[model samples]
Target chain A: MEQPVVTTKDALLHAAGALFAVHGIEGTSIRAIAKESGANIAAVNYHFGSKENLYLAVIRHVLEKTRCHRSEELLKHRRDWEGKPLLCSEAVYRIVEEYIQQFFTGIHPRWYGRIFMRIFLQPTPILWEIINELVMPNFDSLREVLQCCRPGMGKEEADLWLDSFIGELMHYVFAEDFLLIIPGHRKLSDAGYQKDILRHVAKMLIRGLELPVPVFLQEDIVHA
Target chain B: MEQPVVTTKDALLHAAGALFAVHGIEGTSIRAIAKESGANIAAVNYHFGSKENLYLAVIRHVLEKTRCHRSEELLKHRRDWEGKPLLCSEAVYRIVEEYIQQFFTGIHPRWYGRIFMRIFLQPTPILWEIINELVMPNFDSLREVLQCCRPGMGKEEADLWLDSFIGELMHYVFAEDFLLIIPGHRKLSDAGYQKDILRHVAKMLIRGLELPVPVFLQEDIVHA
Candidate 1:
């Protein structure tokens, strides 16, 4: 195996992602990224080639960290890494919890997802392909985990489940503005309860994944 | 009889709202607002008192339109405009759809919310107060609708359901910049597909509302 890469490129990406998150892709520049990373401007040019590629590299870096964190969390709880796994609901629970704690409000506190949203909504053919292929596949693990939770549902139903799974994940990641909401309803502070957003979210997912009461009485009697 | 005041402030707000939707709050100005509305700069100052106030007024104006539209949609489906109730599910659907459409290329658009999110992740107390009173109530309507759909779940479960509901709403709304995954995913060339979005969304929402197999087994007797 390649002895892996040096942390120079990694540090550049880290500095670049924070700057980009705060100022956005257009607002942040190569000069600033070079200055912040303590790397020579030529080094940036040498590695990423341009500011645009640097931005793309920065995004991939953060995504890889996120993916690895969740993957490790899921695998550690399970006995094996690759197998036909019966996913613990707790596995889903931890992914969400760790995602909230480690990523959303983590060191790179600012989120540039709105910028991503802005570009994607323009439906730029390039962005569309990334979302359809790269991002959506991130949730395939969730779909597999969710499958064990709801076996009777059809493929269409399973697809819909993935939609909600990804949808909730999307909103939580991008809609950090609403983080105050947990407290806004007095659901957090004056309500005399400790904040347990992860628990609430996990329980809600379970409810949504489970089946509803049957519409027909005759069918209900035999089924029940 | 107390007639509604036709103050310069109201005119400034009205004019600002339309302009901001097109040019964005940052893109629009007091001078243009005065020019278009046939009001002078001092007239804008007299009403909005400041540019920021004018911008906020624009936001409030669009949000008010959203609320009014929802009221009308639900009322149209109701016998008594005041007493007629929209099903919680329908209400959630309406709020989510309307809110998404409000930003996703619609009759009334305000880039303020998107811009505002960047500025105010940790919003001022006033903004939080306003959102709690306005947006949170809309969210509760969604919660109630899901509750009506799945009455057996506990409150904790419902919290997760709301999380997913908000996610779906935000996903489609913010999907403009989805290129991170879909490399070349761009906007649909055809505007007609926007309706098709609503159909897929409606289907997705229904799936989120459905329970899993354990719950399904509990209701298998039902034809649905």
Candidate 2:
């Protein structure tokens, strides 16, 4: 089958995202992006108005693409759980599992992660917008889920635990290459290894929070 | 007393480290380093031979400086523990605490961390050498300490757990800036906050590994 034609705007964003991932914002030039995308400099200006706008567009494009996929999966999950009552612990496990799988496996072209790491290391002005608009709602949902798991858990304490949980997962995401150097470490690309990580993280969170284990995870806890 | 004079090579390494942290390896130029360090381009060539060599020298300088301080602290801890049977749990706690503090606070000028992060994200050919020479020794020590904590734990399991532990700590180190945007988050620079993080990490690891809590940490576990 013939491939659909890629618009100049999409091509520019893709090219800019890859270059920015490697050289960073200030390091990457409009001319380089234009050349990489096979578009003229004037075309870049016409499409995105400026390099900064183009950078923001690239970030938005990646985030929106991921967010759309996540929303669909989450919608499916909600539909599946509609008639069945999920224990809070089970709910948290599923949430974390879905998050890990989607984050590590669902994102594509690799540059998406690099772009995120670049912005994470050196945040731009749009960071506040991205956090509030795209990140905060998900964080709020996770926080609410944790509170449901352990009633009377103080907001501050719950937030800290959530941070620890996220720190563990983000570390693996960001440092996969570094982690692989350790003896006997498995590839994140391995589906079984991903499940192992999910169980490992869930075990740590459930135990650390002193929450009652769901029946599904009880066996793993014993062996762990 | 008059301030000590900085040598030409030291100046170049310092400048290169800072610039590389901002612009990355390929993005930075030798002329920029020379200008920033107030040395001529010829002087840079005379001192470090090449930009790549200068970059490696910067890495070596930062690692050695931190290692020296770490060695001193470890020596002091050993001396203090002499003739007293230290619990494996306590040893692990102390090692992790020292690591977090040294990694986050002991390194000076801030640019050191930025340089490390840059290298971490965009690894150079020297990464393997660094893994073997600097990182592996510390990792080995942690692994041994963990094994002492939990006898009969498989090497692969122990390694996975160690990665999770390191992942938690590293996430805090790497994502400190992004994390601060979260509501109710504390500054990493705060000494008290660092202790809270240390305790939080220890609690998670101890529970996750099912290790017996040392007498000193028993109270915290109860409250936790």
Candidate 3:
């Protein structure tokens, strides 16, 4: 039988990434990562040189995997709907369904998701760098899909609607603690439940997009 | 003019609340709170008995204020629309608009908001306690309003739709970091923009409730 080999560096990266995801970078210690990985402190120092470098590398590694996986999904969606122009509602539905998959059941490790959420909650300078390289391409892809759904939708308008959709999707995933506490609410363990919720969310987004922009009230103007 | 006197306990709670909002409970230190509040370590000990107690107290204090303020607004809404039947759209719009205001521009201090978001992201045992004592009452109120909007809606169905609306609102506030990065996206500082977004979200939610549940596809069944 062939034995799979795990590099000391890979082990350290995985451990560090998990820790950093649960506990923000400032909250985690190098010693904890070393202990969790079963790597000596010297080995960690030799591999990553510095904690900051290791943190950045871990983010890069996780994001690289996410970007590649999501890009493929986007392509798959395009192929599935090829030659036929999807209706506005269909396009939005597909886009949201894809997002729901990514947010709840994507290939990224559970802890890896924590790192992404942490950055959003408590942003570091590195977030901008990640956004530019990793996030923007994916966001642009979604934006393009949305534009196809609603032709002539301005980027600014799309941005707001897109944010609303993404926000709600993220909340479903991120606010599980709060959600679980609500009377009669269940944990999203069943894949069937996830799909149903996603469809519901997609419908909401489509409806939201169709609503008229309200005329600004004087109070709103004064506040603005 | 009479000057109000603040107790040592109040000082500690105020400082601790701010720090905990910015940093998670695990990330914050007793010494930091003591220093920030200008109350010595001895005073902190004398007042709260322990760090855990102090932390709980701070959360309780913030939540107590939030509950009172939010309850008043909800009552005001009920009173304003008294004797007149509110359209489903109007009820949803009012509910969502109120949420946006409380989230982005509510009476609770900015830092207090952080503690709530943190609980959602990184849950602790205290969250269950808070949810039962503080959050449930408010959520029930929303559910009541929603039931009025869609008369005879089942509790289970209402829970799902309500989650969609709350999830979207929470996302807008929590995902500001990501939103700021999106090209053409602007800060949600304008009251006019806030109202428009609230109306948009409410419309989507109302539409979503009216949407027929999609038939499960073969692929979805397999995947589920």
The best-first sequence of candidates by TM-score reads 2, 3, 1
In Å, residue B175's CA in model 2 sits off its true spot by 1.2
Backbone clash pairs for candidate 2 read: none
Provide interface RMSD per model, one decimal.
6.5, 2.5, 6.6
lDDT of each: 0.52, 0.69, 0.66
Find the 10 residues in a row with the least total lDDT in model 2 chain A: A67-76
Candidate 3 global TM-score: 0.79
lDDT of 1 by residue, A17-67 (tens): 777765556556778888988888777778888877876666655454445
Better of 1 and 3 by TM-score: 3
lDDT of 3 at B116: 70
Q: Whole-model lDDT, candidate 2?
A: 0.69
The most accurate candidate by DockQ is 2
Q: Where does model 1 exceed 4 Å of error?
A: A1-10, A38-47, A68-136, A140-157, A181-195, A211-224, B1-64, B68-164, B176-224
Better of 1 and 3 by lDDT: 3
Looking at model 3 chain A, which ten-residue stretch has the lowest summed lDDT?
Answer: A215-224
Clashing pairs in 3: none
Q: What TM-score, computed on C-alpha atoms, does each candidate reach?
A: 0.55, 0.82, 0.79
The DockQ values of the predictions, listed in order, are 0.27, 0.45, 0.34
Better of 2 and 3 by DockQ: 2
What does candidate 2's lDDT look like per residue over B37-115, in tens digits? 9999888779888888887888777666555233234444554543333444566577667767666664466666667
| lDDT at A69, model 3 | 38
